[model samples]
Target: MLELDGTTMCKPGPLNPSIRAHSSTLTNKRSRRIKGCGALWGEIDHAQGVPAMLLISIQTLLRGALMVGGVSVVLAFSPLPVAAQERMPMRIAVEGAFPPFNYLDANNKLQGFDIDIANALCETGKFECQFIIEKWDDMIPDLIAEKYDAIISSMSMSLERRQKVAFTEKYYNSPSVFIARKDSPITDVSPAALNGKKLGVTSSTAQESYANHFYPDMKKTVFRSSPELYKGLSDGRVDIILEDKLAIYDWIANTKAGTCCAFKGPDLVDVTFFGEGAGIAVRLDDKERLARLNEALKTIKEDGTYDMINAKYFPFSIQ
Candidate 1:
């Protein structure tokens, strides 16, 4: 008699002296037992009382049996080709609120540079990839919790963040800048120039860190998303906002609300706050996946695919 357990196989009666009892845990976390039948049939001698035909049948049965909630269920088994088996799609997380980089369209479909870049990398690498929209503040935490495999969001590679996750080579680089109403008197972003004015920035972003570090005395209003932060500037709730230059440029050139605001000062390039640039993020232990992404990034750039995507969003090269 044979029995299947979640991780071990057992025989009820005495063991056969001729055949040594053996067991093994399968990749799927299930195990099965036939008295004195080792994990591999080749190890068994035909001279033993057990027939070769019977042993082959038992092996087939063991492969098909699956344990579910303490009950054994037999399922039809068909092995797929190695290539077909390796085609499983990797899950990628993106914040669907950052425009020009990534955002939801009027149709609510994800569309932007990050989306295009992610698609290109996956295609060049022969990897199937799926994108999941996630909150900005929750991106890192959820990634660590295994909710997704990697983050292709425009996340800056700052030293503070490197303590938790690893980043691939930068896909794009843009400087931080300040935006304010065209009519506002604040021509300079110096903290002394705008003593009592309200400043807006998205929470848990590189821009926020920059503002907190450089303009610690300025009154700051933190928003949950980029759209909300932009709205705060337009609605007169905030006197100015600090954000990615390319993103602000896209708003000023494309959206109606952006017409009320304009770039306030020169580009801010403090590396302490902005880090290097935006890169894909994965768990610290996922070095193999990181290498695969870096190779794919190189392939796309060398093939002109990355240039094509960049031109779709910005007139100037951000790389």
Candidate 2:
């Protein structure tokens, strides 16, 4: 039996038609053993042990195991050994460099939407959360390989991605916008106009698909990170870059990447190349975690917490 620590259990992935385990899934074998004949009770007090005991009880109940007044749960073959609830920390993967959404602050501490929301989710889910800065390129592969439990990077939920990994409810959304040299001889760049132009985009992303589908004749250069893509455009390696409008505004205001470049229309929306805005990424097998995330997301959105977080980073309403 493979022992899946919380870290190795849930990996990041895109929803796909052909589903792979992505990683070793914890069976929660439940260790169903014949109990004290029927109602063998262990420490079932929530205050004495860890809150996680509640989960064990819940799991046992869901498996057709009976609950004995919340004191001891009746198992099919259980005088359950009832291990003390362990509040172990959960491991998370993130692109620690994306700004506003999830980035390393001046203090070297991770700060961003994903970071904040991850923490909030941990609180709600009652699991310790640790974030690892994984590259965008490797997020899905490593996640499927069981590198981490979840990815809180600014990943969009789209049909293409859904084919590979499962996504939580959308948390943030921004439309796509074209970035070009401010003084370039272009008003509105049409797919035809880009026939021979060098266009830079994030490789293997919806952005690439958008360009390929819309402007097949246009030359496309794909970079791994936003900074790289921005640099490619600023250095004149590429004529234009299509990216999120919010990110574009941030780059233009914060760095010289936007100094000579301006966002050219037609504008980009969630449905464009980026698909839908940001959401949490998890393996397809994590039904519990995915279901939990959706529940928490619904609660946060209903309580206005999500909107508050969004307002702190983005002023304009993109919904």
Q: Which candidate wins on TM-score?
A: 1
Question: Which candidate tops lDDT?
Answer: 1
Q: What are the TM-scores, per candidate, against the unseen true structure?
A: 0.73, 0.71
Q: Report clash pairs, candidate 1.
A: none
Candidate 1, residues 254-273, lDDT tens digits: the string is 99988998998899887777
RMSD of 1: 18.6
Provide the global lDDT of candidate 1 against the true structure: 0.72
As a TM-score, model 1 comes out at 0.73
lDDT of 2 by residue, 107-225 (tens): 44556666667655654454444455555677788877876667877788878788788998887777777889887776667887777888998766677777888888888888876
Give the alpha-carbon lDDT of every model. Answer: 0.72, 0.64
Q: Which stretches of candidate 2 lie over 4 Å from their true place?
A: 1-89, 270-273
